[model samples]
Target: MKKSRLILSLLLAFASTLASAQSENPPPVKEDFKPSVLNQPGKEYPQVNSQGYVRFRIEAPDAQKVHVSLGLGGRGGTALTKGADGIWEGTTEGPLDEGFHYYHLNVDGGTFNDPGTLNFYGSVRWESGIEIPAADQDIYALKDVPHGKVEQILFPSKSTQTSRRAFVYTPPGYGKDRSKKYPVLYLQHGWGEDETAWSNQGHANLIMDNLIAAGKTQPFLIVMTYGMTNEVKFGQLSSFDITPFQTVLLDELIPYVDANYLTQADPAHRAMAGLSMGGMETRTITLANPGVFSYVGLLSGGSISMEDLEKSPDFKKNVKLLFVSYGSRELDNPRRGPWGDPKENTAAVTAAGLKTHFYVSPNTAHEFQSWRRSLYVMAPMLFK
Candidate 1:
């Protein structure tokens, strides 16, 4: 009897300990996910939960392996498991950053777009996109307010020997008042993306519309054009020459815009801003042509050091607004560029009596989210 009692006590203690351990673990995630806002009109496979966890469902019946190219760190991506119902499904191991993310699928070692989501141009190709629902998404949302028109134009580029395409955004009341001329902001996209990125991916027009509607910012004209003039590969950054692109932008695009549109055609009324490689181009072109653009912005691109200003004698006098920004994640490593910290560079410029501004997008990386917010913050401060 004593032996049996001891055995029973031991079993009960083990069971209690197991129960406690189970109780300490987190509960299974709730099933309240919805289709991503970037999904196709009728498709509903890629979904995101309130916690920012992305769930994907693909209908590849015979594929041996299926993977999503978006997840946590590195590029391991998310592997989908085939279920008994012949559908491959999986959820991200952790939450993703809140904003637009470009991703695709690798099915049996073949690259393909997720049929459910709308395609965005990135990484030199059209890839699937998903939005994680940013908390401040309303800033770029389409409302009933007065809207702006994004006009597409083909400008003659003698340097590139082609009629280059550019998109110009005219503010809400632009057409109403034909006598009034607005300041122009020449914006550029990242490496692989072209001019369409600012309107399509970054929602530049909508951001300007919302800001103008709320009387938060003055109405201005925004011009976006292809930043690449030479055919350079992805890995060949050293060979990427800015001379050709600078000529096209400064000589061709600017002259065409000034003649065609009602713009305040002067250095003080002109600004240049770009993202990533576009930012690099902005830094180069703005510094080189200091008298052409008075306002300069570099979003997640790089910084402007005191040495850069010293090289350009007119930069301190001609430039008015020097706006620089980056994603918080990109700043984790202090070593950003050859000039070292971007914050310090901006400070040095500000100390030199130039109007400088710096911004960091929280919980984001070197993606469109950072650039979008940068535009929003920089718009109000331009031509002021």
Candidate 2:
């Protein structure tokens, strides 16, 4: 496949899997709705119950109609009916997967954010966000444990000809113990997202905090920056060039990170991971740079194939670990397209005698939930 078309197919598959439906006869939704955790203070309109169903109540008496553009299976979304009291009310047809989702309100044909919720940067804009409580919510839960800090750092990039922004997650006690050096992971966000997506939407710092509290993973630093994927429209995704962002990450960011922070500045101690389009970038850069990054992860992104091994023999010798993951909904949803099996590709790579691990996040799609779980699962295996 042409390089551009290959990425296009992956993007297409990600979109196709968003269409889902509940069982033909779902159980009755209990009236146990409460305010969403992401809701503004004292706002009770947008709520989720024990079954994962969402309820929205918006007050817009003068508006002709109000509609929420978030629905089960990414279908028609929820249509609101104006009550006599002038408040619009609606409910999702089915329960949503546990995690964060970006949605907006269409009030009288105007795009607007929900007044009752906090906005998250997504789809290249600040969209209202909602969170569904997960069964494994404690994995990324904010606890009383000592936490890592995610600090925004500006690094000069000669290739981009600008001061680029990147978020660095320094583990707890990084400041107190000045002599200790940690490994670094260069993480990238997918299309339509910038440096803040991982910390804001993915709760990466909190995830690491909870993990470290329980002694689950080694203390390390996670660096997040833009992938420069949103410049080309989805229609022109194939024409997306990796060179500009690659230079920013390789030539500029790495050196700044090494000099500014106490890090084991060697290939074996460095890692790279990304999601969706970011994964495509990770694959291209990790293989091409050889000893630059020893660990690699592709979360809901593409996978390594036998052809990849043939083209980059150094990948087998230099890289230490390769982690691949996808949401179960993206993998098994019958409505998806023929994007080929990521599992098969992962298996072929594993059989090639290179260390590889594959994972599937149950009951989720191409969203942050899958990537969160992928990070939780992959972090322990890095720098081992």
Write down the worst ten-residue block by lDDT for model 2. Answer: 332-341
Residue 275 lDDT (model 1): 84
TM-score of each: 0.91, 0.95
Per-residue lDDT over 208-239 for candidate 2, one digit per residue giving the tens place of the 0 to 100 score: 99888899999999999888733665455666
Compare the candidates by lDDT and give the number of the best one.
Answer: 2
Cα error, residue 367 of model 2, in Å, equals 0.9
User: Tens digit of lDDT per residue, candidate 1, span 140-173?
Assistant: 9989999999999998888878899999999987
- List the global CA lDDT of all models: 0.83, 0.85
Error of 1 at 178 (Å): 1.6
Model 1 scores what on Cα lDDT? 0.83
